[model samples]
Target: MMNMITDMKFLNFFKITACLVGIGVATSACAAGSSVLKIEEEKKVPKIQTIKKRDTASVAILGDSLAVGLYIGLTHLARKNEKLKVQKYSRVNTGLVRYDRYDWSKAAKKISQTDDSNIYILMFGANDLQSIRENSKAYHFQSKGWVKHYNERIDEITNAVKKPGREVFWVGLPIVGKSNFADGYQYLNDMFRARAKLNGITYIDSWDWFANSNGKFQMSGETADGKKRLLRAKDKVHFTPAGYADLGVRVAKEMQISN
Candidate 1:
């Protein structure tokens, strides 16, 4: 009887040990599964932040028609990127400060904010190249110091946008086909580069990639996004949706800004 009882106790102890072992196996399996899930969860990249932090980044555009809406609806899409709050400060047929004293005065009065944290992206020279000499809108160029005034005006405009700590990106003029106007474009691009270096700003050279083998304004096939490059319409001066998206991609890449 005693031996039988001892045998029963031994079996009971074995059964208890088996139960503990099973529990440990289940616990270990659950832990391993949880670890794998956590690793997978960490891999996704977030595109936009719905809730803004205390510090908000603001960008403003200061250019001519390009800023006013020249390309593949790019500016609008860029503004809706679910990331940036982009504000365009473009005036058609207008540069940094128009040669017209009255227009410039009115433009200056319209200004309200000038903070360094405010980023400004500027492209100009399309209109300033036009001769508005002494109230003559039709005159292309008879002024003697046109280059000098244009350069100085661009400098002043750049400095104004600087806002002490504000970031500035000045996109250079593109190469154009058959537009003797491109000479002015090249001169303006050179000036922009010099001024950017002087003020420690980023000078984006659109002319480099936008130029064709003939050294004129040409689209690189379709923009990186499969959109055809015809957004400039027949004018080939502005961007199509595809074109702007392509430009936006380049801009985002340069600035390391999110989409």
Candidate 2:
């Protein structure tokens, strides 16, 4: 009964997250036809305007709600370093697929104008597991055509942020409380890792940071003092405040921000 309850919790969490992202359980059937879909050519990275260099430093945080949690954590840790200014450009519920709602490539250009700093922290894809509209065509999630279109968008966003003397830290998605959600994230993470490497950006793997000892999704994790604390929010999607702060500390350190 205990095992059954645990399994049910995982299933419920997966279904809820997928539904919230506008992906219905019926969408799983779309996966079968993915191989039959035609893949498009990957977009070439274009040259963006050269942003002004300044003595001041800033780190632009970009993505969806997960980026908001990441920003909250980064703000607490990065403020200690007076030289580093952490700015958030993330919009909640926005993803690479939802240009009609919000476009990160365009947002990146505007943010570059405001900050003009070299460092960037990008975390996306939590809200992107649904169908995507491309060139008057719609591609379902996990489809080969969807993969092609998604990669193109990722490249577009990455290129829009690249400037002279700039560094981008692309943070990968963390493991959620459901196996299906975890699988989706794993696919997204692989894309992030490959694309970040291809684009010469740093990719931050966050799966283990929120995973259990057995590499499973877990709600609680050990702090620096080895004391276990709740790291997940009730939704099992976003992080708790404590969880974000802890994760932010790691990110700040990775960005070389020290007081």
Candidate 3:
């Protein structure tokens, strides 16, 4: 009878050990499955990409009366963007031709040395339709000598503003109300364009922007909001406040700072 009791006790102990081993195996399998599922879920997640924003532009506007108008317009447009900064260095009745009154090449060199601006906008040729004196010799407008000297002046101004990280933009004259003035301006625009290209500087042409469908001058034009407004002053050479604002919009677009 003792032998029978011993056999029964051994059988019961064996069954308990087998049951414990099965439970441990089941637990280990569940943990392994959960680990694999977690790894797969991690793989399915998308990676996030970062995008960079454009840098701010510090603009310096230098020219004649038209540049003054451009400064006003850019100021108004820049009011909305804190990243854009514009400074005007324009004078009335001043241009590249008359060194006796104001030397733009000297002024540009001075600005380049003193200012921290990255962009320079040059608008002249309004008061430059006159004669240019060199070595006490007069070179009349449209003369070969005058053209050569004017082109050299353009180069001087362009080189003055063009630094290691600076950009230069030469703004061409727009159409005037008087046909004679308009023709003169067209001649000047060609020179400005050629010189700008030769110097690797950008030239902003304002002729077509202010002209009618027939390529003639127009007094009224559409603004940014698509409304017709008087763009030119009564003098027909300079821009009205609204006209300048429109020009500002176009320039801002070129600078890639437009809202």
- Winner by TM-score: 3
| Winning model by lDDT | 3
- Error in Å for residue 70 of model 2: 0.6
Tens-digit lDDT track for model 1 on 1-259?
Answer: 9999999767555544555466444555555555555665545422221222323456676677766552224455556575556666667777643556334323432542543335667777666566545445333442556655556666677666655555677888766653767777787788888777766677888875565556556644556465546534356666656666667666655555655
Range of the 10 consecutive residues with the lowest summed lDDT in candidate 2: 32-41
Please list the residue runs of candidate 2 whose C-alpha ends up more than 4 Å from where it truly belongs after superposition.
1-57
Looking at model 1, the pairs that clash are: 71-239, 72-239, 72-240, 72-241, 116-166, 175-217, 176-217, 231-240
lDDT of candidate 3?
Answer: 0.82
Measured on C-alpha atoms, candidate 2 has an lDDT of 0.79
Error of 3 at 213 (Å): 1.9
List CA RMSD, all candidates.
Answer: 21.4, 17.4, 24.0
Question: How do these models rank on lDDT, best leading?
Answer: 3, 2, 1
Residues 1-259 of candidate 3: C-alpha lDDT, one tens digit per residue: 9999999767545544545465444555555555655776667543221111235888899999888889999998888888889998988888888888898999989998998787888998888888999999999999999999999998898888887667778889988998768888999999998778767777788888888879878899877678899999998888898999899988877666746
Candidates 1 and 2, the one with greater TM-score: 2
Q: Please report the TM-score between candidate 2 and the true structure.
A: 0.75
How much is 138 displaced in model 1, in angstroms? Answer: 12
